[model samples]
Target chain A: MATEGEGSGFAIHPMDQFVIKPLFGGEHVHWYTISNVTLWMALAVLCIVLLLVVGTAKRSIIPSRVQSVAELVYGFIYNMVEEVTGHDGVKYFPYVMTLFLFILFSNLLGLLPMSFATTSHVAVTVVLALMVFVGVTVLGFMRKGVGFLGMFWVSSAPLALRPILALIEVISYFVRPVSHSIRLAGNILAGHAVIKVIAGFATLVVASPFVVGAVGAIYGLELLVAVVQAYVFTILTCVYLRDAVGDAHH
Target chain B: MATGTETAAEAAGHGGGHAVGMPQLDFSTWPHQIFWLLVTLVVIYLVLTRLALPRIGGVLAERSGIITKDIAIADDLKQKALKAERAYNDALAQARADAARIVAEARAAIQADLDAATARADAQIMAKAAESEGRISEIRAGALDAVTEVAQDTAHEIVAALGGKADAGSITAAVAARLKE
Candidate 1:
């Protein structure tokens, strides 16, 4: 399968890092199968529990390190929801917090050596994005009823251009989940793949030093990406929520 | 290096002897990934909604509430201190005024006593001076009478030595006139 150029003991399979393998060692990944995806995701859940539950068990006025971390994450997402969705949107704080913690831990945990990045997969991110999309759509309809469709309709535009503007608005609205999921998956997938490709070059004895240095630098960047991607996803969720809960800007 | 190559070969075998384009695009694993993702999301949602968020929110609210209560108590204490200081100042001013009044009253009382003593002393001195003056006049009167009697006796003896015999009544009359002059 090697193009003759890479046959000289210099091979790079960047995508292999994303492949799902059963945790208990099986070739087939059945729907109910316990795979690496479950392990990392479960680890993320454990981390969330430890930070949120056990860390704050004392319920101290002055928080411990872990408790403060939990509180900081809580406050950060809480404030984001409050600011973006306004006062009325604070009801959705837990949902947004859940999304942020899951993505954040998944991305960070995936950076470990030989660990599968669950967020790097489109299948995982699409479900997350769709949840937000569907939840927001239902909430918008529930709260504002038919007036929710008014979001796509640009009322301020000229009557003749209103339909065109709305068409664009509707397209963009539907495209939100696609773009949202792709953005996160693409970023993680790209960063991991780039690092893998660079590491593959370490086989050439001369490039080994540069490769190591580059990998370190890219790893640092990926850490920042992991956090930023989480923030972006959470903030976008809040922005969508604003449409449902907040007063109409149009 | 051997393990790396072995894993690479094994991955290739899994990929049908070629690297898969993108494991993300593999539809066969989508359902598996989706199911777990849903499970993970549900668990997280439940954990957060049930436990974490409410606790954190309660802690924050409680902290702010404590801070606000502390501030209010501090403010109340400050006001009380100010009131106490004002009361202290008022009492000090009142005591100062009372002390001044007492001193003035004491001074007035002492002055009245001194004035009364001085007036009494003057009345006594005046009475003693009047009595002394009355005694001096009486003594002057007595000395005048003695001088008059002596002059009469001398006049009578002189007339007798001159061998001039006079009547007793005349002699007495002449002595009386001379004494009068």
Candidate 2:
């Protein structure tokens, strides 16, 4: 696999596409400089605007195709937040919908022939998971004061084990953001990498058709993962918010 | 398992210039990724909060309102139609009863007229019979008078012709006694 710049070798470079090179020629990536990541994220935003805002501009009772799509998205995110978080959690529906839509659009768009999968990066997903983590923590403290610390305490456990159980619970509680972000990034990254690896073998004429067919199968699975990951993230956020706002259960 | 392969492939290549590791672990690109992600997500959040969600909510509320109004109108119309139907049936029954009463009244009036006509006809028939009986009785009386007068005159004529004395009072008495015997 270490065949760098070896002219006659048929080596595959899957990570080359993920390099954060500037869109302009010969310029290194800067904080403000536009890059492929900036372009794609903007595109995701554009898509969200088109689907959610522009699509429903007409507000027709008998919805057109775009309107139907907009309504379905609206109802889906709305119902999910309402059901998972309950009435108190419903106030944060827009934030949850925004998170769900952004991730969903990014995952779907990342599947393009040549595009960046932003959600596949830890930098992006960790920020999102941190936002949820920090927001829920702050809300819990604000609403319940010192009682919020009771979240880590296992009250029903035997007194001898409660101290040890609380330590584990606190550690696990802090690890939520790490696992949450990693789960999404890992799923997206692996699916795309497998497809690219399989597609690189397409240059060989003997196994090209079979490999390409397998790529297609993987593509179908990736599509499923794309939507499912978004749903998982949003539902987890709701569950955490419910825990933060709801009565203590454990 | 899959990340190992991806990282291994990345690590094996490009030893001199910017060695690629696990992309998720690559610290160089984190700032770029995080900056753009924050910008994009914040804009998206604002769009949903200020524009999209509200617009969709309005459409839903408007549709529900229109449906409720239409249902209310339909219910009102149904009640009105039911009331009209009830009134029409009642009027129809009243008209039938009225028609029956009119037929009975007409029949009774006709019976009374027929009875009056029959009574008038019976009175006329009784008067005509009584008048005929009176005329017959008068004619019998006249015939009886004529027979008595003729018998007396004949007896007087016969007595004179036979050369015997004719007495008017004695002839009358003898005729009457012979007629009685």
Candidate 3:
């Protein structure tokens, strides 16, 4: 039997990465690069497509259990949209539901042994954030024209302080996507790093079953955090979309 | 110099200077933000346009159709009920008119019967009065004949008691003398 460190240290752990230059070598890439993250994202998208197609292929007056579950999910998202964005929010229900389901599944997939957590990468998260940011901005402008600019200004504040308030508001509005992206990436990366460090330490200590058990418990906890983080990200996206389309006063 | 010192420390710990641990953050390899941004936008756009929006629209349309059909069925039932109510009222009015005609006819028949009975009773009373008048006249004639017979018998007895050949004036004088003595 091979010792613990004998077989290339657990076969490189799949997602573990180090910087390397290609043979042609104008640029360098990490072991777990953007290409890997893109592949996983595509996989997650495919999973969602398969889920929807399979869930809704058969239509029945009294639905089968699978179809009922699918309808329940649809209703849950619809109610959430209505709660956050009122009745008009229903039009955007599909986009919001897909975003939620895709991210949730991706996060769960990452929890499997040797699976890559694509959400841990800042680039991928940033792209998701930027999409939301641009989408809302476009919708705002399309709905309200030049008046969309007034969302940052023309608050219920007194006229004398309007300029100063508007400046702060504009800066905050610009920071929305950055904060959104960073919050998700930071949480995922930190959680994974901690688990990795603990597991590494666990290997060093022998005759300490307690330590191993504790680490196992923490791993379970990390799975819960994964789901929660996905939910939080999707809910925040909905709130931002609501602000973009709805009246600012509300 | 710092790199040399780190390599020396690693070599002292192990036979070689191969660092084996988690990698440090390298922000330099970050992708151009615009490229990823465009990719995400396109993905979101496609998702909304191709999949999400159509499903939501189908659900809403199905729900609307159900509601409209329910309303139409409700309206049809209401119209039927209204027609039934109108027909019932018409039947009730016709019944009332028939009842009134029957009542009037019964009252007229009773009035005619009473007038005919009153005429018959008056004729019976007139016939009884004429029979009673004829019985009263016969009884008066019988009483007058009895009075005449009694007067003739008294006159004969008085003549037999006086004498055999005595005239009426002598007998009258003799009877007066006998009474005076």
Candidate 4:
């Protein structure tokens, strides 16, 4: 927010891309105002439906390319959910899969030139992270009841150190959503910002070629980060859900 | 970056009510973004649960079921084929056994016929031999009688020629008694 790359004749304002404005000609945003974030998010769902629903309309034993993709994603999520959370947690597979697909699509689609990244915005990611946090917490309490609190209560330590460990555990447990949301957003935000910074350096006459090359290379790395961040976010959700169903805490 | 964006915004004549900070930090759009996110997530969830997931899961289960049923049917057919082969073998063995029994009966019947023919031939040969022996005896008797008469004549002539006392009847009786003994 403090740096200015306007020393050269070309004043490249990379952070301007992150600005959220009303889709229509309006100075103020309303609750129902159509925005770029809304458009991209809807597009993500459209892609998902097209891929999953339309692709598998035939449901042939021998899958078409579209059906293959849909089934592959389904099986991938199904196996991950089963492995991380066990069969007992598979009942919630649809919800977890939905979240994973939505985030994955958002991250990948955000990589398009001149496109907005939904996952980079805390407003978007916080809601997703909070959903997992709340859902898992509710499930934990419902399934394990008071025993769920035992996660924070360390039993294997000396009596004096036990309280300190328990306090630390409690703080860390509450920090799950904060870190979960911020981790994805921060990774995406940092990558995009770095690319913008490198692109802005392309305006320099002497360093133009190197800066452009570096930007291209960073774009490739950003693509990997896009998928990896989504994977990490999803697997972490599965791990938390496992704690809920299995209650490894106690 | 602040002055640069401001200068750029000024150059574009897009003046913000307050300096446009990080668009993500803009609280005014949070409601818009969050509201849409919530709506979209709910929509995605409903779409998946209602349509996409169940369809995909159903296809998988149906494929598995088809494969399992096909395997079971194949197994059933294989078992039937084995049963047919076993029945065919039993029938083949029965036919071989029947053929052997028939051959054995035919040989026994032929042997019985051969034994009867041999017995009849031996009886005929014995009868022929008896008849021939009877003829020979008769002929021998006739020859013996002739020889006795000749011996008697010779004896009588010798007695007459030598002028000695000799009887032809006595000589013939003695010769006949010796032949009988």
Candidate 5:
């Protein structure tokens, strides 16, 4: 791709930014290798710590700036879990909060110059989505026994159409993880890649101003996307969890 | 030209690991990315579950609890204030009623005293008038007797001057009859 772009009178290797490279300078990437992924992930962890742990060290009834942010995020995710999954699903709050904060911080950090976006990769998002998927499935079985399969049965459907609806329900149920993971990975990947491609045009002196303005606009949009994607991912997890722990009224 | 050659050389060297298509599909780096991602997720999970979530949750709960308690206290204070105002109003009414009663009692006492004084003055005036009436009647009776005697003496002198004998018994009887008339 770089060579092709070189032939086209411009050098733009947009995918280069997503390349995995060791931090200490080496050609090899091992499972134990410390890479840019580690650094950015560590930064996210630090941000979480600063906002959640140290910011609230005083336990003040009136919160400081960082403490209030921490409290807002907590209440936001906690209420989401409680409302979507109902009261019983409140136990999974920590898991949902973990994913939300990690994705939210990663997406925002990736917007910085020369920063790597961890959530843009399929591997990371796949693990996250699968965790929610497997957990909800297992919890459904545990809580409802064989009754969990009844979700796909669609008892409200007419008897003649019940089988077809059940088949559709089952297929959609299995597709959740794929759609869940791809939705997040695709959004981040596309946004970052678009920005890179637009920035590549800035190499020309004439287009630099417009490129800068466009990139700025996209950056603002990406910021909204970052928070929104995180919210969507968490709320979807809560919705899936509701199938497991929610009442049988549906 | 030299830098371009070096960059090409570097790219050639990394050809073993470089992604020809999307870096996201680079099969060789999957293990490395997956491992780091797992570590990150685990660390985040532990940090949140063990530290962050509980603290934030506690702070939120405590804040709401404090707010509810404060509201309760404010309500209690309002009730107390209302009670105090009612007590103050009741005391004011009681004082006003007492003042009116005291004024009425004082007015009644003053009216009784004034009536007694008027009665005593009237009795004294009546007694003085009666005693003056007795003295006046006594003086009138004495004057009548003196007038009769004077009349008798004058009559006797008139007869003597006319060269007629004057009898004391007839003159006395005539004076007496004249006085009676």
Candidate 6:
């Protein structure tokens, strides 16, 4: 009376890492680690490099299909930069375009079975976030110098509370990178982990086709989540870049 | 401070949870960052500044050349039309001059013919006048003789009717009367 292939099912924690390390770590440090997350990151970079190289190799009056696609991506990023940062934003087009392409490729790569979502890892996300934070902070100082510090305070508040407000502003500024990294990692980790849990249930429950169908539907929904998360990350990066260059109220 | 080997051993046993504890600001990552950033920046700059912009500029230049060439052709056509009009006007003027010359020549020829006809008429009149002069004198003499005869006849008839004297003085009077008539 029992259905086949029914068991409690093997559970996998979303934080699991498959590490690959070398023998020595001295002057000529021969060390390499291949984790699920790192694998997807490397793949994303490769994809982006290939796209850039192949798309622009042949410069023609009348563009080929690949060239047009590259142009479209360029135009899209250009407009996005212009809209957020106004006229001065065009100078940052290259950075914004790279960010979009990298995150988009990484997200898509993670969608593959057994592939790690690098963005889901706090370390990787933190690195990217910190890079933005440091870059923006340096830019602000370079552009405005000592005056840039005033960006945190001197809002429409009363002059009496300016000191307290400035302290609060400093704290908020420090939290920026942490929040940015956590937002990306949390969304990706939750989605992938939910899918994994549902899939595991589907494997364990052989008697109910309904349960399997439900899990399949959730998996399909996860695909949409993956793309949405990538878009959100890119857009947020753009917003941050705009704030970095423009008025601090952003 | 755990050695590299200890960290790996710990990572293996704990499933790589060591990455979550505290982030070590690895100086090694800086080289990678700088290298990648420079590579990206240079490649993008070369593509946009060198390749794409130049191609777009060439297309614009070629279009300008075509438009200027078209204008030149139009100007040339206009000049040719003006030249043709001038030639047509010159040919018409020549034809008008030729017509005026032919008309003047025809008028002169007609005038010469009229002068010759007038001269011929004057010569005929002179010749006729000379020939008619002698005939006219002979006619006058004959007429005078006929008048004397008629008078003598008439006087004789009258004297015979009257039966008075028939003298020389009466006869002379009768001759004078007949001449008067």
Estimate TM-scores for all models: 0.77, 0.77, 0.56, 0.72, 0.80, 0.55
On DockQ, the stronger of 3 and 5 is 5
Off by over 4 Å in 2: A1-11, B1-19, B103-181
Candidate 4 C-alpha lDDT tens digits along B123-172: 99999999999999999988987888887787778878899777766877
- lDDT by residue (tens digit), candidate 6, A14-94: 333222222122221122332333345557766755555565556554667765666656666667778877676568666
Preferred candidate (lDDT higher): 3 or 4: 4
Candidate 5: segments with Cα more than 4 A from true spot:
A1-9, B1-19, B111-181
Listed for each candidate, the true contacts retained, as a fraction, are 0.66, 0.54, 0.05, 0.58, 0.61, 0.03
lDDT tens digits, residue span B9-118, model 6: 34433433333221222223223333433443355445544554344345445556877998999999999999999999999999999999999998999889988987
Best by DockQ: 5
Q: List the residue pairs that clash in candidate 5.
A: none
Q: Tell me the tens digit of each residue's lDDT in model 3 across B98-155.
A: 9999999999999899889888877887787777778777777666555444443444
How much lDDT does each candidate structure score?
Answer: 0.88, 0.84, 0.63, 0.84, 0.86, 0.62
**Sequence-dependent TM-score of model 5:** 0.80
Among the numbered candidates, top lDDT falls to 1
User: Which run of 10 residues does model 2 chain B get worst, by summed lDDT?
Assistant: B10-19
**Order of candidate numbers by TM-score, starting with the best:** 5, 1, 2, 4, 3, 6
| Candidates 1 and 4 compared by TM-score, better number | 1
TM-score of the second chain of model 3 compared to its true counterpart: 0.43
Per-residue accuracy of model 2 over B96-157 as CA lDDT, tens digit each: 99999999999999999999999998999899989989999998888877776777888888
- Answer with 2 or 5, whichever has the higher TM-score: 5
Q: What tens digits encode model 5's per-residue C-alpha lDDT throughout A93-205?
A: 88889889999999989888899999998978888899999999999999999999999887888999989998999999999999999999999999998888888888789
CA shift of B150, model 2, Å = 32
lDDT (Cα, tens digit) per residue for candidate 3, span A201-245: 454446247657766887888788888887788788888887777
Question: In candidate 4, which residue pairs clash?
Answer: A3-B1, A4-B1
Better of 2 and 5 by DockQ: 5
TM-scores for chain A over all candidates: 0.97, 0.94, 0.79, 0.94, 0.97, 0.79
Better of 1 and 2 by TM-score: 1
DockQ of each: 0.31, 0.26, 0.04, 0.26, 0.32, 0.03
